[model samples]
Target: MSWQLYEKARGLLSEEFGGIKKSFGGKITIALCYPNTYQIGMSNLGFQKIYYLLNQHDDVLCERVFLPFPKDEFSFKKKNIPLFSLESQTPVHNFDILCLSVTFEADYINILKILNLSHIPLKCKDRSEKHPFVLMGGICATFNPEPLSDFIDIFFIGEGDEAIDEFVDAVRCFSLAINKGKDGFYKRLSTIDGIYIPSAYDVTYKDSGAIEMVLPKNGFPQKIKRRWVKDLNKTPTSSKIITSNTVFGDMFLIEVERGCGKHCRFCLAGYSYRPVRNYSAEVILKEVSEGLRHRKKIGLIGSAICDSPYIDEICDGIAKMGGTISVSSLRLDRLSKKLVDLLSVSGHRTATIAPEAGSERLRRVINKETSDDEILDAVQFMTSAGLTDFKLYFLIGLPTETDDDIDAIINLTKRIKHSILKIAKSKGHLGNITLSVNPFIPKPFTPYQWERMEDTKSLNSKIKMIKSGLKGVSNINIIHELPKWSFVQALLSRGDRRVGELLYKCCELNGDWFKTFRETNINPDFYIYRERDFNEVLPWDHIDSGIRKNYLIKEARKSKEEKTTLPCPEVGECRRCGDLGCVMNI
Candidate 1:
């Protein structure tokens, strides 16, 4: 409640963040935080969106904060200076709430660092009414919040547009009633939409290694429907876009659609965000008009931008307005001429295609039914439409992946390059193609959860062999992720509540992963590299996200048996996914 930190954070805002100072209006201090370093956090569109959203609230002023970089962390520790918000150089503790936007499993530890910097306790039980209430949102919260539940005060599930608005309203009301309000705000806040107070529930694990029951102990609803905007077109993306310091700097971001119907077996987004939705053509044009004022380039954001019925119209509108556009990779099976022509005319030279796998056989395992011929056809379209450069994305080490199946990577890329070359010779155009090889990490609730990740050595060898085979394909190039990051991601994604210790240790050691491992008593490999039994109880069993465990088990069984499952049509009740209790419900 002290203004000391707020003054420091406000100083930072005035000195470094020009846009933030302009939006501050000399009152109402709030810190919109991305729980990672400036370099990495600034890259996320969600983080930027929240920064833009909060600042636009007239009565409320928004500032910025990110996880301190390693060097900055050392400097702060040496000087004993607390972490401050970007806008006012105000201390993180001074804000009414320290709102964190967490997008990935790995960033869980970073929240601990930000909290420690704010002089707040790492664990929730260690804090009191004197501290800033910590609230978190984003994809991980939507899927699973139990592992980190003991620390965060509030977990927001699903889309934040509607959920956060409700949260802000509740906070404002609480601010007005603080002097005479009843006790246990956590219990009261849990009653709000999309809000799950982790402290209000009780869980009983059965002896059979399953969650026996999750009873709502307080006055909170048992089920929290995910907040979704009925009319996404009017939901922001306005002129005051925050692009100056972000990864996609000076680029306008426009949403073409939200949700998807592809319903891939191993994809959580395919299941969790049910019933596809999109912006109308008119709304899209309006968004773009506002976006282009800040930047000349547009990055269309969505699960399947191509699937938006009005994608062509939107792309054309941007082009006609003298803006360039970058698109998400497509199914290739659905790449259309109007889309290609619109992009080509805008001087867009590179197009991306996500085949997911080299062979159609592996594609079927993931429910990506696009054929090799279809992919080749898309390459031909890109080439013929005067867009020569292309990037191909593929996954390796999926369940049922064999050496023969992997050869398709080389085969497909070379064949694609040959087609592009043949067309280029006739059409007098030259082009280069790139193939980004990524390893497939099986995730929980996905059909492949039952499958084991391919041994790291084997996957790397396969990558090397594939690259070796491309000796003569000059037009083709290859790039891939370091295997270690994937290994860490696997370790974190499925880890139990026990991992909180490791994450806290990680941030405490200045983001040193190795030292964090040494300090922890638990073996991370046990949760990461080890396989789980079908009857084992997971750490995230307490939160209810609306999906069912039975369905996930069935899907896992189907994947194990090499059988394909069809997506339920968007007709009636959306069947629950196997993981029942999740913050997605929260």
Candidate 2:
């Protein structure tokens, strides 16, 4: 081990406010790995929450590890030192279990880099009893685990609130009986719900390179259903460590709600995290009161923040504690005056809203359920509440998008900026507006899962058209994501085990995807541009998100017909969307 690297990590740990450290002796040691830089990984509330949850077990001791820094990577390679944990500077291979929290598809290549730098085998089949078992979870794991299935040993199928406890129990039971070999160990884990053991299943491919069938052996469940916490008040899902190293370092974060009731056809979270659940006002007030002791700013995190029944009270309570409040992008329809008033008094200067598409026709196809006039009204309300900085998020290359729709985006943005100026000038102030445009990437388990992604050439042309239309607009900043990177995201989100070969080629080329494609025989376009039929077997069919296939197909047909589906009922009525059972549990 490198003493210099160990001291650097220890120095950072000492500066944190609530970092946990424990002895690994006579305990089931687990390395909680994040495949990103320390600064970025430490900022994630999910990573911090899982670290806190795992350490609560008396028999388990969890430590943190991240991808080595650029200079540290070279130094470790020169010294032949394996990646070590932050708590005690112990090698990762020395731990009994190695669990990963993967949130983004673009980080798939970084996972490969972490394994190679740690001197661990990249493929799960090559690992043995001497190596620590590799487990994966998070949003990326929940929807589709096939792209990296060849590497992950086990995948936690859903939310980590309850799944973490279930996993720790399995670890404890398996460790006590050392005589139980690998087969016995797998069988014991299979008995637990929400755990997917990929090695125990075999996937067959058809002649046309599509999935034929997935067979289970040794009584493994044919379809792995996702697990989630029924009650949000039962657990604490907040940031445990406070340090000024991450992007959100100055703020303490808490999840006010989970799942989205607004079922947008193009959104994966809307379909995957079904049956919206929210933390009660009392629970949120308790967390905010406790969090104020460490930080002055509190970020309310949720996919549907405005949907919470107690959002106004939560925001008001935080203000009483003398803490500034930050929130995720809010829904346009739910942007009430009372909510905006709470935000203005809580020292919020910037507001964000996502109008997903510009034209009403395009919006109906994706089920955004918001009109251009409604978006303008929301902005007027926000500015009236004293917000000086505004952000508008939109997406390009959507299904059924036309050149006129692209022009509508420019016209819509200009109208929004004009409204902001009209409101600002009345208040003796000027405001700035930022436009964030991104390319569309079809994800698995959503209504648009089988939709074909627009090629880079077409996306680039559309992007240029938007830029040209907004050329002379002042106080409006246009920021768009590159088309090339979106292509990479689409491939990873819509690929199978066959994509594993491309990952290896990328590692050898040192993160160069274009060159890797040229050198290898794999055609990236096959995965990105190919549209599938509803009857064909999808890559993620083996893992069920509790949403039935028939419902999604029906929704896709409705999308083509330009019909809109209603949002989830606020009163928690049974809608029979196949997640009705989970809704009943709430």
Candidate 3:
């Protein structure tokens, strides 16, 4: 019975990963821990992409280990069996390396829980050459890593396609050096690109609650250069794809491009992944070729796909290859006639457009500078292109949103729907539109850092106002996200190490979110739904993203006064974001 789970893992693995023995000469055991549930972990395209990559290496053997389900956890507890890899049934402590891939801030607690169950030390200093090398890579570590600094040994920042390939070779070299009686294998690993060893750095806080300095203890680079993969089209993310069950079971996803050209002031991905990198048209066409074989629809992922600069060329390529392509998000300013016409040919009915805010003033405040004319033009273009069903995304509770500003939402939708109805009726085409409204959640490393989220009750009340104004619209569908969930996202996004324990308590209590107030004996409101002084030390202060604090403070003040600030996309070379090293010269 104990080995039943083990045997199933082996059979499934052998069927999918039997060819692993044919890339390296020496045997290497790797445990890929998702640090979340099977359903949650399985859903991640980034996680699965790597799983396929490592298993293809003949010298490297990889297996899956996820945060256990409740029933499986109970079974393990009853038998006193340690957390082990699914493929070889080998305990995690026996593997040479434990690689955790993460996406969100909330998953930090689960990372610790997975480590504890795997018999690994909770602290970085306690682990030595005898145990598995603990490493982490994902968006979280790239931006704000101080909160998880105590636990993770090494962090791989930015894109990992080229970095991970180089990383495996380095790991193999280090292991061989260690076996040959050279003791400094760990230090040697720190010298690689995109790898950050926090233990070698020193952080000092001033009495006034500001970071005095972040210095390296031993010989280390002062500032690490983020890794870059020049041609995304050649070595695109998923060359050999995985087919199985996932959290997003009903959908098939394809990476259209990575990084963003539009530098929305609040976006970290805009700064961290730069130079407007994209996969070539041929690469996108090939991935979609495989996607067409799937039962589900293919999702085109990117910071903004419509602004790919050569989107018409790419969409036309995808259209020539047969498949329904669902894009991540679109900018109204970038939809050209050729692009819209190509979308018509591809048989896409539903699309999403994010204006961010209802009012032009608020839109400009966040550097989302598309005009009302552009939006109406986009609607007309889509109307001509046969796009009837689509969504309009807006953010309520913005830094400077007023009653008139909120009323702009009612007015904007009213105008767009009126045009759609008139255009549809004259042409005898039936078009259905949905307006999705959500509250704004400010995160660290954004220009809105010093700003606070509005209370949930007020946000709901404003939503009610929008609903009342939209009652007269006959054919439009409207959806609003629950403010409470946004509140949880805010809490986790801006929280420190203290809230990590709170996440475990929430998991134990089955996610009664408000219960954090009782369990932690602290007000969740203080950290999330309230404003903070500009002078205080932020929890993410110890980590440097190269953006200055004064710039964020200035932007926050500008937002409050309803003043508009623009990024490079709107103002061109006249604007600079202070993180000059992170931006593209073009």
Candidate 4:
């Protein structure tokens, strides 16, 4: 059984391209561990990007390891087998460094599972010098590393492309330095920019369980500035591996842009990844041409790929090459006819737009900066351009949302569907609309970061209200994310290290978050249902994600007043956010 499991892993890796095949002798053996299944982890471009970057180094040998399949975990534990990597089939614990790519907060428990299966200590302090040093990176780690800080030795607080070289160089330097111990290496690692050694910091809490302060010691910087590649054109991001076993399978993915210029107050990615960046048209087309050789489908991914200045050219180039182009959601206001026409020619049937809120007032509150007319116009253009399927995205439980706003969603969708049907009738076809609604979870570093997530009872009430309001609407499908699950997301998103225990309990209960909460004596309300004061220290306050707290505070105040911030300053000076020393030229 154990041999079968190991072979299964080997078989999966054998299907990939651009994976590292290196000799581990006299090299920094690093296990690039993802706390998830192989199929899911392999699908992530960021994970693939890190693997590509780490393996480019001659002194480092990075191998892939993931949380075992449930059945395989049982088989391994029964056989007393240690978790091993796909490349060398070496035990994960035998590596010098364990670099974890954690994008989602829910995967926190899975990290623990991976540790236990590998026979490594779960807590950072529990591990001796003999054990592999664990470092974490990804979107989740940059903004809020505190939740999993206890278990992780180091957190890379920036883009992997920018931090990987610095990180590996630090590791190389530390290995050769005098006093090759944990403490010495940690201090050395801290000196490198964007590396946060959690143990070097002390977090104090107030009597009300709110953060009092987070103080850094041992010469660690109190604030770690997020790093970015100065010129995005220099480091173009694209898929390195191609497999048919995952989402976007067999589709070559390229990141056209990074960081959103739209300062949507409810979005964490918008603020956490500051100062928009995009690859030039030449670079994008070059990558797309290379991708066409391997796969005919191209997926343009980024927070704001539509905002790429050369988006029309990129789309047209792909269309001319006879390659199908897929994209992330389009910005309604920024939606273009040429792009939509190219997408239609590429065989895309559905177009997605996130209005975020149904009501204009609520849109203003969230700084969505999109109007109803703008959304309808975009939809009309897409529907007329041969796109029949329409997907509208929205968020419930917004800061100032009401029942009227919920009803507006139904009315708005009806208008969009009416437009779609008219366009489709002329083409002798019908249309379908899918509404993907989610409950808003105020995230760290956003203007709404200090706001409370609506209670599950209130969230459920709103969901039902929307459902009833949309009842009997033909050709329209409503899919809402479970609010109860979002409560767990909010808890983990803004939680401290103490929440790690709750995560462990949940794993023990077989992923039962409710029972875990009850058994751990944790009140989900404390994290989700209470509004925070401006004076209170947030869990992620120590991490400088290129945004100022005062700016966020002012933005929060503006949200209450239904005011909006301008789009990101891509051309001129916008001193509205970030610290004084930000690298953004604008």
Per-model C-alpha RMSD: 4.6, 1.5, 4.3, 1.7
lDDT of 3 at 17: 22
**What is the TM-score of each predicted model, taking all chains together?**
0.87, 0.97, 0.83, 0.97
Q: For candidate 4, write residues 1-586 as lDDT tens digits.
A: 6789878987887787767789978888899988898889988888988898888899999999988888899987899899999887899999999999998987888988898889898888799888999989988999888878878998988887887887888889877778788877888788777888889999888889988898999588999878766787877889888887677786999988888878899988887677777788899999999999989989998898778878888888888888888887888887767788878987889988889899889999999877788888888788889988988899999998888898888788888888889888888878999999899999998998899998889889988887888789888899988988899899999888778788767767878888887787767688788999998888888887878888989999999999988886666556668653433322
What root-mean-square deviation over C-alphas does model 4 reach? 1.7
Question: Higher-lDDT candidate among 1 and 3?
Answer: 1
Q: Candidate 3, residues 358-390: lDDT per residue as tens digits?
A: 878878777778888788888877886787666
Superposition error at 98 for model 3 (Å): 2.0
- Report the alpha-carbon TM-score of model 2 versus the true structure: 0.97
Each prediction's whole-model lDDT (CA): 0.71, 0.86, 0.70, 0.85
Clashes of each: 29, 0, 2, 0
Off-target runs (Cα >4 Å) in candidate 4 are: 580-586
- Choose the strongest candidate by lDDT: 2
For model 2, state the Cα shift of residue 99 in Å. 0.3
lDDT by residue (171-216, candidate 2, tens digit) is 8888999585777878888888788888898989898888999898
Error of 1 at 487 (Å): 1.9
Q: Give a tens-digit lDDT track for model 1, residues 1-586.
A: 3344345444434433226554444345667788886656766767767777766666677777888767676666666778887755767887777888888877877778778878888888798777777888887777667768668878887777765566666676676674623245665577676787766777665664345666777577776655555557667543243535556666677767776667577676765565566778888888788777777888788887777778778877887898887776765765757778777776778888888788888877777777888888888878888878889888888878889888988898888888888887776666798889987776765555555666678889989988898987787889998666776676676665556677767766877877778777877666556666666655554444455667667766766566666644434334445332221101
- The count of backbone overlaps in candidate 2 is 0
Give residue 316's lDDT in candidate 2 (0 to 100). Answer: 76
- Which portions of model 2 miss their true places by more than 4 Å? 584-586
